[model samples]
Target chain A: MRNLHTDEIIKNIKEMCIEANYKLASDVEERVRGAYDQEATALGKQILGQLAENLDIASEDSIPICQDTGMAIIFIKLGQDVHIEGMDLEDAVNEGIRQGYEEGYLRKSVVGDPLIRINTKDNTPGIIHYEIVAGDRVEITVAPKGFGSENMSRVYMLKPSDGVEGVKRAVLETVKLAGPNACPPIVVGVGIGGSFEKCAVLSKKALTRSMDTSSPIEHIRELEDELLLEINQLGIGPGGFGGKVTALGVNIETYPTHIAGLPVAINICCHVNRHVSRVL
Target chain B: MDQYINTPLTMDKVKGLQAGDYVYITGTIYTARDAAHQRMYQAMEEGKEIPFDLKDSILYYLGPTPAREGQVIGSAGPTTSSRMDKYTPLLLDNGLKGMIGKGKRSKEVVESMVKNKAVYFAAVGGAGALLSKKIKASKVIAYDDLGTEAIRELYVEDFPVIVVIDSKGNNLYEIVLQSS
Candidate 1:
């Protein structure tokens, strides 16, 4: 059995928050750099070029790539054999977020209550997802998701007969509807074949999956490639100024579902899809 | 084409801009987002004098991150503008000459822009780090308690934007849709 202190978790989470905001994961960054050559439209190329410059500036000067540093979303894979010591797990995680936002100069985007709409002052109370894995290590992933694309995410409760074609149609329609609003040159995360809520979570997880990698499941891998091709053909382009590079990548995650339903969700993320992971 | 101009735009300047025209704006503009828009709209509704001058002014839909030590401002950039659509028409009617933000505006907002001879500008979304360099100065002018949503008076130099909707109501978004 492995013993871990909450202090260590707090320290790592704090650094992860700042790191995720400052830099795009390497797999994603490589695609963004290559996108300038792939983009067909002159204006689209220009937009992509600016995005590359923004990425450089963000890293070099220690500034966040986007003003909306986003609501903190953390996913942790806790080892069943490991014991944690210190504060409650949730508070330690939030304390990390609070320090990261304050010290890193990231935006405090959260409001304590939806209706009252007062700023939380410090960006805290992050959404954390925990999974118990068979190991002695605790893995944490920090993804600060911006709301522009978050607000555009959608889920469909498909009838069993809707099938793969229906899934494709739904994704296309959502991308078309999003147009420039989702901040094109997006990372499209698709979740298929799960319960409604499960699919939504899977979709968000899909964004964290490495862009250089594809699903191990053969059919899901094919779907990812096909959807990516179709989305880029969308003419949404970079900055939605019209071009052939509307999406940097399309990632799909699937799970078993009831025979009666084939639920699907699309969690759209802009080019600034910030996520960082660490193991302790 | 890139045209350089100052804010507190006049009718002639507004008319000169067309959909798809790129611009670099230098001078003063007021920043406000959802909350401040609501408050200003309510103030105008209540027949109270709004804090900033509306005539020929540009309302930038931005909620910037707080500046770090020795920095002018933290990652400043435009936010989604449609959320402010409900409060936009009244400001345009009173004398708002331009609005700077990203995404499509509502039909009513566009129509009001046409009626008031105003323009809508789109900045590249998520390009905050680069955009912040263009903002030379910033200070909260009103609603300081609203935090990031507070109204800020900003002095910008050669800040880039594209005219998405012109004074005559030609919208670049629709044009892109139709052409494709």
Candidate 2:
């Protein structure tokens, strides 16, 4: 068994948080450039161009790409064979989050109460989601979820008979309702099957995939292409300006559903697309 | 393609703007979001004076991250305008002339812009770091207790934005969605 020191994990987590917020991943940058080329409308092309510029400026300056900087959302895939040596695993993750937000100068947007809000000085106690898997190495992913697109996310419990068309309709309706509010030329992450909460997880997880990769399921792949075409047709251009491209891409993930219901969820992500991962 | 030159922009300057124009704003602006606006408007509701003069002034809907060493401001960019839509008309009625933020605004606010000769601008939502370069200095003027949501006096130079809603009640969001 490989023993990982708690201090080491905490240190790595802090660095990962700072690095992810400061820099746009190369894969994300390349995909934005690719979208700029494929964008059919002049306005859409311009919007993507500006996005590319934003990334460049943020990276060079070592600052966050978006003001929201988001809540520090961490997903952990723990290896059963490995042992956490120095500190509680959860404590290590939270310490990393606290240090990152404070050291990186990122905003502390988290509030004490969802109802009667009170500010937490440092963005602490990250919303950590963990999954245990058979392996020797632990994997971690950090996604900074901004409020705009997160506000537009939705989940629907559909009748099993509703089938594929139901899923498409729900996805389209969500985007349409979102309109310019989610930020145009956005990325749409759709999760089909699973329970309500699990479906939401699947939707967010779907967003972590490389933007250039296609869905493994053939039917879902075709659905993604069709939806991408349809979403762009909505004409919500860059920054919600009049343009030809409404969305940059559509990605879908699925799992077996309960025999009684077909569940679907949609997670909308803004252009900042801030997320980073590490293996330990 | 039209321009609104200079800053501390008057109603005359803002009213002249129309949708689809790119604007370079320079000079002084104040920052406020949900909390500060609510508090200020509440003061106004109680017939008390606001912290700053609203007439001919532009308000940026942003809650910037804390600044690092030697930096005037951190990644300072706009937040969603729709979240502040509830309190905006009241501010507009009290001499607010311009707003800078992303996402859609209420029809009532657009009507207020048309009625009061104001303009609405949009700064790129995710381009916080790039936008921070335009801010020369920032000092909290009111509601420091609100943390990031505090009201601030900011000096900006050539701050890039697009005229999203003009005095004529033209809305770029409506136009864009229609065309799409």
Candidate 3:
């Protein structure tokens, strides 16, 4: 069994939180640049130019990509053969989060209660989703979710008869409703074939996929391409100015669902899709 | 390209501008969002003086990330404008000149824009880090207790923005959405 010390885990999580908030993943950045090249609308193209310039300034200045530094969402893939020493894994993760937000100067957007709306300073008690995997390495991913795009996300439980068409409709509708609000030329991550909550999980998980990669399933790939074209046809271009590039890509991840249900969920992210992963 | 920049936008100047003109903003602007807007407006209803002057001033609907060391502000990008639609007309009536944020405004706000001769500018959303570079200084002016939602006076220079809704009620959102 590989033993991971508490200090190392804390340090790794702390750095990951800060780095994830500050940098735009290269894959996402490259896609935005590609979209800029393909965009036709003069106004839309201008907006893309500004977006590109903004990305440069962000990286050079070492500031966050967006003001909605967002609530901390930590995904942990704990290796079965790994054991944490000196501290509970969750506690270490939370501690790292506390230090990261405080030291890195990222906003603390998490509230103590959904109803009462009391903020938990330091962005503590991150929204952690854990999966135990067969390995000797523990992996952590921090993806901060902004409110505008997050509010536009959706989940649907369709009758199995609806099938692929149903999934396409949900994905397109999400983009349509989101329009400019989700920050156009957005990324669409679709989660299919899971239970309701699991579908939501899969949708977020799908966002972690490499931007240059496509879904392996040919039908799903077709769905992704079709949805991307249909959404751009809506003319919600860069900043909704009107152009050919409304969505950068549509990524779909599917799992086996119950015989009676077809569940679909979409986790939409803006142009500044910032996330990072680290192994400790 | 005619570049007209006003440090502190005056209502008269704002009311005079037409659609499709470029304006680079500078100097002080306030930051506020949903919760802060509600409280400020509620105070206005009670006949209380607002925390800051609304006349001829720009209010950026943003909740910024925390500032790193030696930095005046953090990644400060615009939130969606429609969410604040309900409260905008109230501020317009009180002499607010312009709004700086991204996304579309409500039909009601556009109507108010026409009637009041106001303008809405689109600051690049999700470009907080880059945008913050233009802000030379920042100080919380009101609702300091509100954390990121607090109203702040940010001193900026050549802060880039596009005029989305102009004084004539020529809404870029409507124009683009319908024709495109």
As for TM-score, the candidate ahead, 1 or 3, is: 1
Candidate 1 vs candidate 2, lDDT winner:
1
lDDT per residue (tens digit) for residues A95-152 in model 1 = 9999999988888999989999888899878999999999999999999999999988
lDDT of model 2, residue A266:
97
Which CAPRI level is candidate 1?
medium
For model 2, the docking class works out as medium
lDDT of each: 0.91, 0.85, 0.83
Each candidate's number of clashing pairs is: 0, 2, 0
Number of the top lDDT candidate = 1
The deviation in Å at residue B169 for candidate 3 is 3.1
**Interface DockQ of each model:** 0.80, 0.77, 0.73
Per-residue alpha-carbon lDDT of model 1 for B1-180, expressed as tens digits?
789999779998998899988899999998999899999999999999998999999988898888887778889878888999999999999999999999888999989998899999999999999999999999998999998889999999999998999999998878876787
| Cα RMSD for candidates in order | 0.9, 1.7, 2.0
DockQ score for model 1, please?
A: 0.80
Question: What residue pairs clash in candidate 1, if any at all?
Answer: none
Of the two candidates 1 and 2, the one with more favorable DockQ, higher being better, is 1
Q: Which regions of candidate 3 deviate over 4 angstroms?
A: B1-3, B15-20
For A1-280, candidate 2 gives per-residue lDDT tens digits of 8898888778888888888887867766776767777777665676678777778877787778878888888999999999989878999998998888888888999887878888888887688889999988999998878888999999999999999889989999998878767766688899999999999999998887778788988999999999988887776767777666667778899999899999999999887677888998
TM-score of 1: 0.99
Residue A115 error for model 2, in Å?
A: 1.5
